[model samples]
Target: MGLEPFSAEDPIFEDEDVLRDSHKPEDLLERDRELEEYQSALKPVIKGARPRNIFLYGQTGVGKTVATQLIMDRLQEDQEGYDNLYVRVVHVVCKNLNSSYQVAVKLVNEFRGPNNKVPTTGYPPDTIYEFLWEHLKDVDATHVLFVLDEVDAIGDDDDILYELPRANDNGNVPADETKVGVIGISNKFTFRDNLSARVKDSLCDEEIHFPPYDANQLRNILQQRAENAFVDGVLEDDIVPLAAAFAGQESGSARQALKLLFKAGDIARSRDLEKVKEEHVREAEPKIKESQVRNELESVPTQSHLTLYALLMLERQEDLPAKSSDIYEVYEIAAKRIDADVKTDRTIRDRLSQLKLKGFLDVDEHNEGPKGGSYYLYEFGDIRPDMVEEVLRDVDRLEDLFQKEITSY
Candidate 1:
């Protein structure tokens, strides 16, 4: 073949739209059975009867939120003629609403809409719930459907989930009349197990488990996106399957799969290539992983970040693995520097364990019962020293901001 006068280093895509679409569950191909199951869960509300609370537990990006939203739209449309059906649905993401009172205040503010704002930390718990109850009554939202995505973030404070289902029973409304159903969505199956017995019994009337999509399923989903999202013949035949395989291997997340497709396309475009190929997908893997790591670093709880910052600082100063007691000193100083609330040493240790579980740090055990004696040490993993320094530098900027708040106080 004669030279086409194009750069060999560049790839050209047939179409670019496939790389840009945000996928919803309905957009997912070959998940009809799961979709039907989700639809069936909302069927009772259509007949104007009380709905059962639902718990949706699954891995991240497995279509939990998308499926819920899809079914909710159908329910709202179908229930238009049911006169007694005072159906109201509110979706709250609990990642940032870590406290029950914060959640209650958020619900009240959501109900109030544009006219009011609730302080994140200033409200009394009872007062906040009172407002929430009043708002529910005012809207005549007796059949209230509350979906708390990432319900695990609220930790020990599951009062919103527990009390919401029993709101009518507690005299907030008539005992058997004011129907409220909660759908708690969690990434961790252990979240329900950790809940108080009372809370678990009330909030988990019916549970729906969403499993990760397999490789073939991901291929079908990606193919569907390619058809609608990309221009004709823009993607090489292998690109879709390759992206699908990577996604399945990583976490079986459609979000991750779609992100990979987009990143590959961006790489193609930047290099002035005409079509995205399997090679582009390979090239984009590290970029995707780096972005994932960055997002994880950004989303950690403030206290956890403080603990990590302490470890990174200690590591910089010492050669050997550091013990908990030594790290606690650094953590206390870091917390005070940030003007952040300081938990007890045990609490900090627990936070460290949580971080380890999340795969951000590594813990080492040493024997010292006798001559060698007993000791344990901690070190960070996969997280590089340079990366640690960068995170700490950014956190120090945050410390400066916190100092301003202290002075204002």
Candidate 2:
């Protein structure tokens, strides 16, 4: 039976998420060389050679994620029936996890099945690590692949990266055992340079660098996404260049280009238009910018979180490097507005101190002449006042959605 077509006004592709996720690394195109290289690196481990640790460095959105997914897919397919091989690939994004303890807890939970739920906070690091090792040992896998993405975000916690590779190395391996490997992927090239010398020697045994995508690469990537997202010939010829140019101009990020293309397509389809246009692409720029700001805010520490909201309020109300007192007042107001507990001024001051340490906020010391009062002026380092305000609004809106459950629980 033929399916009835929707009215002419209805869009061809009813769902928008399909468009947004079309260029995901799993669905990535034209990266066969990289896929092959990474596969070759893993070939030794699959053949039972002592697994090695690898580090993948790349700029954001340049196909690091897509290439990793593609290679892992092939690895799984190739190793389907190797009973002696316990090949566990755990992927964790370190941005949301600030401490090694949190990362271990996440890893343990991922390794654990439904009956076991690890605690989120307050488990001693040693206990968590012990539990994780036991879980790994229980799985009896010959190879364990820990894929730590954005490793720098772990915030000075290098314990997991340091210990995982040496898991079976400590003489208790029954003299012969299958090995473990680590794959640490990061955008920060200097992350290893900053790590302790011991960590440097351990986790970075082998390295792969994924350079940013060129304009041609971005075009090819967008073309691949376009094929899956739109019906044949629905996307205009200019859309690919426009998306690729904008994305390449920013950071050679295929993800960013694909996001713009997806958004532009959404705009086109929403208007019941036949093709994406330059106007639609132009309109998507601000949306992407806003999204980036919101994501940054979400990743900031809780103290910096409140400080940003306070700074925003002060800026909107008056010019600022706002006196510490004025900023505190705004913070209190913001706390009440968001229904979060109002921390003491001392706590807020500590937050400001940490922000300064992290280079997000500047603290200017002032000493009045003779015995007069002395204090420090507070202001943001790189974040803008307006962007701060917008992120605060987004935070408040998201909080509103969950406030009831929060209060009830």
Candidate 3:
């Protein structure tokens, strides 16, 4: 058969960009309460007072970043009434930035412009802070807001969070020239709880919590995007509700809900179907979940992969909910079979703990009476054993192990 020709006209999508994460809607829907609290947090800026350091906490896809962008846009437009006030917002996504020094360098580079960018390393932490302060003075705005997205990635090195909020009081920048405030956005619920007392006091002056959207709310959000995303008659009546139910019951993430609808549309267009039906959305569910699992698996270390593989083997033999000691035994054999370095049992346990934290494993702790000790049992969490095996096979070193079926010692 000849190669299929490209379609002359597309029928499914009118404006596909509307469904994307980067697209910001003019108004946030179903977020009135959170938005009110958010507006109240920034009310000081309009009155020519220093802006409060705001902490926005929520699970992923609950509209934290989008809501912030919406408020910032409105704040800029309304500030026109005040002649003396100047407001500027600098956004930095710290997902890959791990230390206070790196985040400081990023801020300095943002203020210094592209041509004056600094290397990621080779600077002392104090010098970086000084440079940041110098650049803040140069901006010369009455109030400057730093929106640090995924601020939890900085981990224990939270000096940037503590310092930026106190830049004026600490004499880093003159109090009259530029007042700096930090707005930290984190998807990790424990990020705020893990902050040091001093950092919490300064950075979390005003906290706003965004709860996950329920089914009705997800349906409304999906319907709004669907109007702009697909051609008017392309979506069947039940499409939005089914997608919303899946996302609402599973994650309650607006982003996830939107993604499901987008994927279903693509599937319909692929089959050259006129309308998106229930089957299309049903098919899209597993594809989206598999993609999410693969992306997460790629982020972990190789040792973690071996640890998970060992669990997969035990699960296949109906031996799951196994203890760490039993897992270590299988893990050691798998490591040797692949000719990989064998980690000590303690180290293997650490890898197991890391995998558990990443949501790849479920763990239960058991304790004996007073004189006895405590131990934990492990099994796959949420993810299926076959899915874990499939993804692990993609790793070059683990490929041979799967082929040889060397699961037993």
Best-to-worst lDDT order: 3, 1, 2
Model 2 TM: 0.72
- Model 2, stretches more than 4 Å misplaced? 1-18, 22-27, 30-33, 80-86, 171-175, 189-193, 300-384, 392-409
Whole-model lDDT per candidate: 0.76, 0.71, 0.88
lDDT of 1 by residue, 159-216 (tens): 8888887776677845345567788999875566678889878887777888888878
Estimate candidate 1's RMSD in Å: 5.6
Give TM per candidate.
0.82, 0.72, 0.84
Model 2, C-alpha of 58: deviation from truth (Å): 2.3
| Candidate 3 deviant stretches above 4 angstroms | 296-320, 325-359, 363-375, 385-409
Clash count of each predicted structure: 17, 3, 0
lDDT score for candidate 2 against the true structure: 0.71
lDDT of 2 by residue, 1-409 (tens): 9976766553434334554643344455666666666777888877767767888888777777667767777777777766566566777777667777888899889877788788798788888888877776666567678888787788567888788767777532321443667788887654656777777778877778787787888888777657766777776788888888888876677777878888888788878788777888889977875675467566664555777767665565565677778888877765676667778899788778866664557778888987987889887776676666556556643354224322210
Q: Rank the candidates by TM-score, best first.
A: 3, 1, 2
Per-model C-alpha RMSD: 5.6, 7.1, 4.5
Lowest lDDT 10-residue stretch of candidate 3: 292-301
Candidate 3, residue 214: the lDDT equals 95
